[model samples]
Target: MSQAPQTAQQPVILTGDRPTGPLHLGHFVGSLRSRVELQHTHRQHVLLADTQAMTDNAHDPDKVRRNVLEVALDYLAVGIDPALTTIAVQSHLPALAELTLLYLNFVTVARLERNPTIKEEIHARGFGRDIPAGFLCYPVAQAADITGFKAQVVPVGEDQAPLIEQTNEIVRRINRQVDAELLPEAQALIPEMGRLPGIDGKAKMSKSLGNSIPLSSTADEITHAVKQMYTDPNHLRASDPGTVEGNVVFTYLDVFDPRKEEVEALKDHYRRGGLGDMVVKRRLEEVLQNLLAPIRERRTQLAADPGYVFGILREGTRKSQDITQATLDEVRGALGTFSFDRS
Candidate 1:
């Protein structure tokens, strides 16, 4: 599903996690792994998108602030080097807010409502007719986040294509209006494992849904979550033939297990009967533990040094601010007479 634009040189990349909670395995498989790999080949900027998180969680500012460090730990634990990738806090970049305000003029409320990602998220949040204006306008802010860095590549799940498309539309509209290519049209780099289903067999893994296994979960927690994971409901006995298509356990194994042959064999055994749920659960538990153990260890070490983690974020924010200021200057200069200074 990954689609990188053809280019002679490496393109600047912008990607991020909403700092509302600790990142989960869904984040790991979807974007974090690719980001770690992409940093070596591209100019990367990873945002702790607190402002975007606040679009929905506006009532809990403290929760957002606390999770900023938690999300940063997850990034560093998973090998996202700040030296290679600028990891910036979204709220610190004031220029993004200004850019969002300006970009709002180019798009209409109807267009925002039609953004598939926003629409899906609003329904997921159960906002219905009471959707927050900030939540509705998040696409414009996202456009600012991408263009402020002049990012040409944005790694995201397939569901987020609408956001990238919306950003590019704004980029095209602004370019045509000003007779200048003021911003780059960022491309979406969708991962092969685009979305991970929840452990409860839900369509998507979400923190609010209480089905996600957090990246920072301990070995015991991992085991517990796996034990409760939903498998075929009709396969009630160990001797009963089981289905793997909709089984969350097999789904996770398919994504996380390196030994494809082993997983396939296990699937065959289960389908033929005699392979109990406990057997499959134990194997999955082992696979997940092996995958996450090192990450947890690294996260523990990084957590002990809070100053170093925050120091990385502070330095990154400064670097991002410089880039954003340059973009804002160009955007303001193009509009003529509107002055929004970073000072």
Candidate 2:
């Protein structure tokens, strides 16, 4: 007999990123680092969400296509071992598409519109009445992705917790429709460090806003980005007291710096007056360079052997295809769909 979804041995985790751009520092702090750690203890599946990226980037299909490999390289560079985790491309998995269609029947458009994550995204994209049907139904697709794999845990930012809630609602509806506990509901595992803000101190670090530092950024690029990070505009002189609450440099340092005592001392000094922004920025730069150096080198090495990376993806996707197909077969049978094989 197969194990339960939440079996203590190795629970399944489904988490992924949209292939609209390369991942950045925000991704690392928010979820990627946890993913690296979780792989050792969980059956993890990371999806390259290219199809979802197209909901908004429909006009620029090539951009999404190119970033699929870029995102894959970022994953490999960050120490996500393909041997321990399955890394599959969304478009390559046909079962996910079919499952999405079937799951749509269990959800309503009104509820999709009410999903907090979807609402925020729609407002951010400024898609008022012109929201794409696909974009509005993204939560359904995510439900398909989760239930198709019977994922018991999903790592996501706090803002995305509502989507997981909606996914569970769909799972419950499906169980009622079929009168069987055929699908597993997922729980969101939010990181201790929540969403990282943009360099400009915006609420989000987004590539489209040009306020993000890509994972593949060079030393010079890292330095330049750090220099431009938002600090207290009132702190004109080094001796002037600065606020740490909104200082982006100190925020990055808190997350990236290893010496907690040193960071706390610096924070106290900044609040007390005498520490310059550049002084703190330099420290942050050193910490970031140290953290990203090995990752960048690994990414460069992986990029050179595209064939090897592609092979990993192909093999992972093949494994995922079988798993999803089995789930689909079970779902279809429960829904009483006619299968030629059953004839």
Candidate 3:
């Protein structure tokens, strides 16, 4: 989900992915694709959230540092024009940190505990038994990221609606606590295709789960990944009545392959038991290869000019800094947090 704010007149959209690995197909359908679409429609700010990545993976700078450029390259290669989009490094926006400090006071310790996103994450990471302070409080940081930019619309999946609620609560609470409207409330932009599934068919597609198809993957890598994708476990025989409801193969086809009639026919064939899993997988591979060929080719070209990608991020940070600075000024002034303290 994006932390961006939606405005009345082309509200600004703020969103980004972490740098733990290269961009994957999940990133494209889920967020990046919409980001490019929103460029001409709204004011967009794309953040490479290396800071948030540090919350849990703080110990691994090597992994974080290596993928930083890769993420940016994926952004540009996928058609996120730097000219239209403001690309910023998360940590570079110091106003966000400053805003976080103020927001921390408005939210209680119990409130943070009740956040559904944090709870799910804690459970997902097996940290339910023990949660880190940074991991818990970063939601407030995310609140700051949204309010600092005064974003109006955040693109997100239905599953991530709770995060949007949290952002809005913070926005309202901050305005009420300070007795002034210092921040802008934001909403969500949920796309038709909510969350992408993993190749292993384990719910959502994530890198940690090892069930992802990375954007930086070569044609051969794509071939390998699709060939091994999980299908209906119950259907073992060639003529066995198969299911595609939860199968990763059909789910992928539903999202990537636009030919509705053909994909549906394939699904029906599998349901009736005549179609083999191999045939479906092969068809899926063909569909994915066609869908990803352009993206892969573009990523290759961007990778060759790494310096240019970094330059885009640097320039984006510069652009974001200007607006964030103004927002900070107004926020501090509203709460008497700014200097001129004659005590």
Candidate that scores best on TM-score: 2
TM-score rank, highest first? 2, 1, 3
Q: After superposition, which runs of candidate 1 have C-alpha atoms over 4 Å from their true positions?
A: 1-8, 338-343
Clashing residue pairs in candidate 1 are none
lDDT of 1 by residue, 194-264 (tens): 68999999988989899999999999999999999999999999999999999999999999999999999
For model 2, how does the per-residue alpha-carbon lDDT over 1-343 read when each residue is reduced to its tens digit? Answer: 2222323478899999999899999998888899888887889999999988889999999999999999999999998888788999999999999999988888888898888898888998999999999999988999999998999999878888998998899899989889999998899998898889999999889898999999999999999999999999899999999999989998888888999999999999999999999999999999999999999999999999999999999998999999999999999999889999887
- Model 3, span 1-343: residue lDDT tens: 3534444478788888778898888889988888888987788888888888888888797788888888898888888888778889988889888888888988889988998878888887887666778889888888888887888888877766777788889889878978887777888888877778899887778887899998777789889999889999899987999998999999999888889899999989899998899999898899888878888898898888888888888899998888888888788877777476522
lDDT of 2 at 54: 87
TM-score of each: 0.93, 0.96, 0.92
What ordering of candidates by lDDT runs from best to worst? 1, 2, 3
RMSD of candidate 3 to the truth, in angstroms, is 3.4
Q: What does the lDDT read for residue 163 in candidate 1?
A: 94
| Residue 199 error, candidate 2, Å | 1.4
The count of residue-pair clashes in candidate 3 stands at 9
Estimate the overall C-alpha local distance difference test score of candidate 1: 0.92
**Cα misplacement distance, residue 271 of candidate 1 (Å):** 0.9
